[model samples]
Target: MPVIALLLLDGVPGPHVTTPGVCFGTAARCHPRVAYEVRLCAAPGFRSAGGPGAFGVTTPWGLDGLDTLAEGDTVVVAGHSGHPDGPPPGVVAALRSATARGCRIGAVGAGTFTLAATGLLDGRRASTAPGLAAELARRHPAVDVAPDGAVVVDGPFHTATGVLGGVDLFLRLITLDHGDAVAVETERQMFLELYEPGPDQGVRADAPLPGDALGPTLGWLEARLDRPLTLDDLAGHAGLTVRGLSRRFRAETGLPPLQYLLRARIQRAQRLLERGDEPVARIAARTGLGTPANLRHHFQRYTGTTPSVYRAAFRSLVTSLTPPREVPPPGPGGPPAR
Candidate 1:
């Protein structure tokens, strides 16, 4: 398996040390086959220094053990609790050598500062924790500090905004290694769902929708999916202008209102295709897609398969779930009685 070297520094927080392991380790299990091997490595000068649950982490590998990092392997730098000056010179050299050998680099939380110190982030766009972005920008003049992104990927480096962002980054890497299906299962195992806008914005699948602002509007829209609804209708229903409604929809769902509506229609069509034997024409009409060709276009665009093919696949899956019934043998010259 490909290996991921999770580098921890002295005084690093516990989550920074553990989150990468859990995320990638769980991904390995969730995949049909193991995706990557995770190795926890502490700097040679590592001395855990913090309070409560975040202190005194033990690791089997130190900076010296980074010999295992090879081309296509990953090196994740965890944030330290001390000033963001950087890790030991030995650790920096090891990271630089590993990068030269074609290993991908990642920084979590304030670890971006350490990676920035190596000058690899020079002229690269990266984001750190929300509060530390300013200091990182001030300290590293050449690095393009992204103040608001949860996860920033520029070339061979990946930088995350916080510990949870670390989880997202690993999951994204898993998706790149495996596929979206494996990543979805992995996220499910973590009791989380992949939020399109990234979780740094605090939105998640299981979390309640933005009800106070859009609940009534959503209900109004759902009740009228069979009818043609425009942006003006949505804005008027929500008592907002078009621009205001668009902004609120983007904030809540990470998409424009029309885009969300299109997704919603496709989802509804998917349910009908899976659970019922409705014709594509009827489904299309009911979902306000107007015509079968239009439904097929949008359906394939969103789901990557034609409506008929999707229905066949769903039916095949449903059939596999049901056991076959046994039939009695025929008696005499005639068939057996019921």
Candidate 2:
């Protein structure tokens, strides 16, 4: 089982500690094969804060829990009231050490302040609680504070707002470690007991179309992900002129047809790299990238890392660190429709 160390610092709210445990623990109970052994550890200076006046907090582990972040382990820094300008000494060192050791590091709420203080998030895109994002950006010029999103996954580091956001992060991790089917099952269980909606239930209004009109064409393209597709071919299949196809495709997918194909190919490449043992060359062929060299170019362009590095970081559970991947900036046109 993968170990998840919850690093608790002084003045941390109680929920920040328990939420991850509940999320990972429930998933573990449901699927032991993908279970995480959660360890709540007291940082160099841990104290309970932000709970009900009558409540208190405690943990069984301390700095030694940092050791659990060996290969497939994760270390999540719980939010605290301590100085963001200067977090506790041992904790910063520990976080840096964990990064070097290939651990997937995460911060929650104000805990992002501590992460920023460590210089790990420098040049990486991250998100914190909405109210704290600007402050984090102001404090760390190298860290790009994402304008929106409750959960943000860069490379090895993940960050979220608070308890609910942490849940989103854990669910994502579950999907990465297991698969969508298992993640969906676990999510259904969470909702059955907590009366909460799953992530799919929350849709953004400004998001791209669900491909209603282009559904059949979208399905055709996805089914032929390995094909050497082209704009003219797509237009022919859709029974429309190239210009007409571009207009409707952009209207629905919010991306030009070629760009959309690239995204889809890269997405497929990522899945194969993470869950399969196929060689990079073979994956490239199957994803229709033609060659490993070409695959590397587009993979790095979109995910900011090579397929090998991405696989190493996630497949091994935690062991490689690469810069966070960026979403492709918006462009024109979109995929084919029929």
Candidate 3:
């Protein structure tokens, strides 16, 4: 069991603050073998949601209470804070101290703004919502920023694009710490339905090709995701000369075989990233993208955002939609496909 200290900001959106607590709360409460302990730590006497007057809420510990941060623990920073331009000095100190002690750090949406304040993201990769990317880049020119993905896990730091997908990013982190089976079981138990990974992994075919030689050829192309299949290679698989296969494939698909293959490759890479926590290197290999550099190169050209950013945004979006599976029944259980 891992204890997750979820750091709340002054302006964190109501949904971002409450949903993870409810979802993970349910998951941890029901599961016998694994338990995820979550602590809601806010600035001293600072109440973000359901104010003292409305819900009579109060934080157990302010910044001073942040002493719980230590090794083998995680610090999750939430967004929608009143002052996202930066975190309070004391809060910043806590995050820096946590990092010094080897505590894993994560931020959601605008929360990345605070992490960047510490100079830890310099030359390191991170993600934020598109609305704030330019400002993030403008303020900290040294930190790499990706604003489209639901979330981005760079080194020990995890970032989300917006408040929408914070829970998904958190679940992915749990999956990274535990395992897929645990993560999936929790999800199933929670009955979460709002989560949609990314990119389409299904093979596309207008069934009954009417004796189209290129029909099986498409499946063959998909099968060789791990191997580089050039036009010649595809032609070989189709049992035709290079010119013949190229013409046929293009005529049938309305695109050149190479172009279609590249699109398919990028889409598959996307699915692997959003649903599975495979490293960019492994995904690159499995998708025949070869290297991380190559994956980023193709991903940027196709999606206008790097794969890293795309993953972050995807996670953030998922989290925002799907509350913790731990929430009492009928909380949030959406379909699990995009």
TM-score of each: 0.56, 0.56, 0.54
Scored by lDDT, the top model is: 1
- Candidate 2, residues 86-196: lDDT per residue as tens digits? 787687888999999999998888888888888999989888877778888898999999866467888899988764537767887788887775665565455434223
List the candidate 3 regions with Cα displacement exceeding 4 Å: 50-56, 163-165, 191-338
Which ranges of candidate 2 are over 4 A from the true structure?
52-54, 83-85, 163-165, 194-338
The deviation in Å at residue 81 for candidate 3 is: 3.8
Worst 10 residues of 2 by lDDT: 200-209
Q: Encode model 1's per-residue lDDT on 276-318: one tens digit a residue.
A: 8889999999999999999999877765678898778767755
For TM-score, the strongest prediction is 1
Error (Å) of candidate 3 at residue 197 is 26
TM-score, prediction 3: 0.54
Q: Local error of candidate 2 at 88, Å?
A: 0.8
RMSD of each: 20.2, 19.0, 18.7
The lDDT of each candidate is: 0.76, 0.74, 0.70
Clashing pairs in 1: none
TM-score, predicted candidate 2 vs. hidden true structure: 0.56
lDDT preference between candidates 1 and 2, better one = 1
